[model samples]
Target: MNPRRTTRSSSTAKAPHRHPRHPHNPAGRGTGRLLAAVVAATACLGVYAVPAHAAPAATGTEPVVSRGVTIPAFYNPPARLPAADGALVRTEPLTLGLRLPGLDGRPIPGTATRLMYKSTDAGGLPVAVTGAYVEPSAAWKGGGPRPLVALASGTMGQGDQCAPSLALEHPLTIGNKTLSVGYDNLAVYRFLAAGAAVVVTDYAGLGSTDRLHTYVNRVDEGHALLDAARAAHRVAGASITEGSRVGLYGYSQGGGASAAAAELQPSYAPDVNLAGTYAGAPPADLTEVMKGIDGSALAGALGWSINGFAQTDPSLRAVVDAHINATGKAALADTSTMCVGDAILGYGFTNSKKWTADGKPIADIIAAEPKLQAVLAAQRIGRLKPAAPVRLATGIQDDIVGHKQARQLAVDWCRKGADVTYKAVILPNLGDKLLTNHLAPLLTDQGSAVSWLTDRLSGKPVTSNCWTMPVQP
Candidate 1:
């Protein structure tokens, strides 16, 4: 789970489906340029880290607006939730921080509505999740009713302000309020430009103030995504309908979310007309994934996982809390309030060994503690067969998120008779530990992934490559 950053000033960058609810690539030398740009830009990030303006939500329904960023007040759930999951909570006009106006004065990409909808968490409790629904002004040339895409974001961070809905409004934000790079805006607009409706979930507890963002919790993520689709149909002006062919798109953390949703759709959200799914570098096995990024550029994300795991499972929390040292506690506290960019610049290449009371890395601790291992095992995504056709891809040289485990997900699905298309992306090691191998493929393979999903949305069927996929690497 991670982020591929983009910026405006220079810097960068949600749900559960308990009840029936809604809801790529590698390449190129440009990867070298991108890696260099990131390195160059990071050295100066400290100067920009100022304190943000604050607006507390103690009494009224008011957003926390700081700099240009906003965490909408609508995120607050009512004390009473509707009987059905995916029930609409509220909606507001969401203005895009970056938008192109056509000659006629209409946003060329689309008009967006801020959404708060009900979704069941992994614990089967009702939660209010926030997101954005975009109705494209562009015409659909590829198909039937305009296809609806539920776009799941990769690892943003653990902060409430890091929500993708807010990012759509403020593409670049920094300082105490948040440190973000909204690279996903390009992906959002791409689908809009293709004449598709898009709904983006903020996930349970992410934008909502009820709890901590449960990062990489598969059931929670799957339910949130599926519920977003269910709620999309309720948006008053949205072009999305129950009949619209639904496509899932995600990479990194989002990859796992989309993959989970793909499997859960048939049972948890029978109403969602799922057509195809693209899961790029999915961390299907969290045990392996947790070890993969431990000392990489975005090592702070490990704290996010711990913070999330602790929030949902008291057993996991007990284990983590007992073994964690003061350094670990401080790191978790710091990362819980940061975005991916903040994590990268601050905790890059730091070892997890520094966090443990016994000076052992978390993976080793889990190896010694079976209770923690069970938590990770429960989070695994490959056990169930994914619905519809799925395109799973991974970078061969990825040091973060683990390429082998991602490919294994495709193999697992293939064995269970799911239609699968697997791609092994070959990329030069642009950075030894700077995340180039993992992040590069996201940018390079995006076009091919989008085309693949669009083809399925357009009713074009693809043949499965399962027969040729051998276990050997």
Candidate 2:
């Protein structure tokens, strides 16, 4: 989801300046200090209403990533977690603002919880993952136990401060964009309005403090999403049980997670009775997406992906070092410390040739290497059949994650004998306009996608349209 820059004066102190993404609004730099004193005075006057769920009093020990920074104690997982995957580690009550970024000004009436749960990493090592659970204030009018949707957020940058949990607490502004006012929060509000309990995964490393987020790593993302559903059921005050009907929803980065979880559910979490999934604008082929973003507004995303690959895969690291030029090395280093806003500002519409000794995109370098190709192939979706029906939506002229590869996903799954509904959004005007093609459908098609998943969760019969669709090239 593309964040619309915020219009508010910098009355708020930006989260810390450890990252280059935190550009100080000089006009509002010290206002937060004044506001803090006002809050203290107000507390002394005893005029403030208490939050529904009081945060725990104990503070968590900071991790190496933010050694000198202060983080709330709720993010800390227990020192020891059960060896089993999908085990609930610990939970605490959380309260989000009534008004969030994309809610169209409609208040979100609900009880929220922050959950830390056990899940496997890409290599099957047990690790802790954090997520938020919301039991809607809206009543369930559908039927049976209120359904649960594991809502995964799209690219929120790799910064810990950009984590959705923190954004839900106090919106972080990237440039002028406040994260709490974006499409991800809007989607959560919609789910709650439909009377579904929602659990949003911060993904493996994004909120872990010590870990460098893995970005597009499929295994880690899928594991985190499925395990989030497991943790949601165990959350205190949540009446959801193992038998509760489950669905997955996400777009962009989130689309990748939902798609991967649907495929992994058969083996990784066979106990979860998944109803359906709606994946919008999923980067089905990371290699293709990497090439597509090389010189675009999101070119920094390519750097982010490369940085993540180097962190997790040793072979890829060696290859990157072997061919990367000095300029490329510095840019990559700089990208590591910045969030999406700074990345876009620094690297947008820039050529990848400047980064390579051979003057070619990194994708070309990886394509030439069999080992690197294998690494990317492992991250691709459609290798396994989804256990449940899937609804996939992509704009025909999407420039970032091209429609061709996204359409190919439907083809691959259909051949694998899975039921898939492929909807190709036709927006020639938006497509001709450049990047808006990819983002427009996120708003337009979301309601339909939600309605489709809601139908499945309500136990309606699914009619597969795979055979009638044209074969993707």
Best by TM-score: 1
lDDT of 1 at 351: 81
Listed in order, each prediction's TM-score against the native is: 0.88, 0.83
Distance (Å) between predicted and true CA of 332, model 2? 2.5
**Prediction-by-prediction clash tally:** 21, 5
Name the regions of candidate 1 deviating beyond 4 angstroms.
Answer: 1-52, 55-59, 62-70, 471-473
Candidate 1 per-residue C-alpha lDDT over 1-473 given as tens digits, one digit per residue, 9 for 90 to 100: 11211111211111110111100012223333443465454333222333443434445554443223444457656778787888898899998776778777778688999999999889888888899999898988987888999999988887777888877876666664346766677788888989989999888877775677889999999999999989999999887777999999999989999999999999899889999999999999999998888887778899999888887876566677789987787777767657786666667677899889999998999899988888899999989987799999999888898988998999999999999999988888877667888888998999999999999999997999998787434
- The predictions' CA RMSDs to the true structure, in order, are 8.1, 8.7
User: CA lDDT, every prediction?
Assistant: 0.79, 0.72
Candidate 2 per-residue lDDT, tens place, 266-345, comes to 99999888999999999989989887778766676776687777777755777888888877877675565445544555
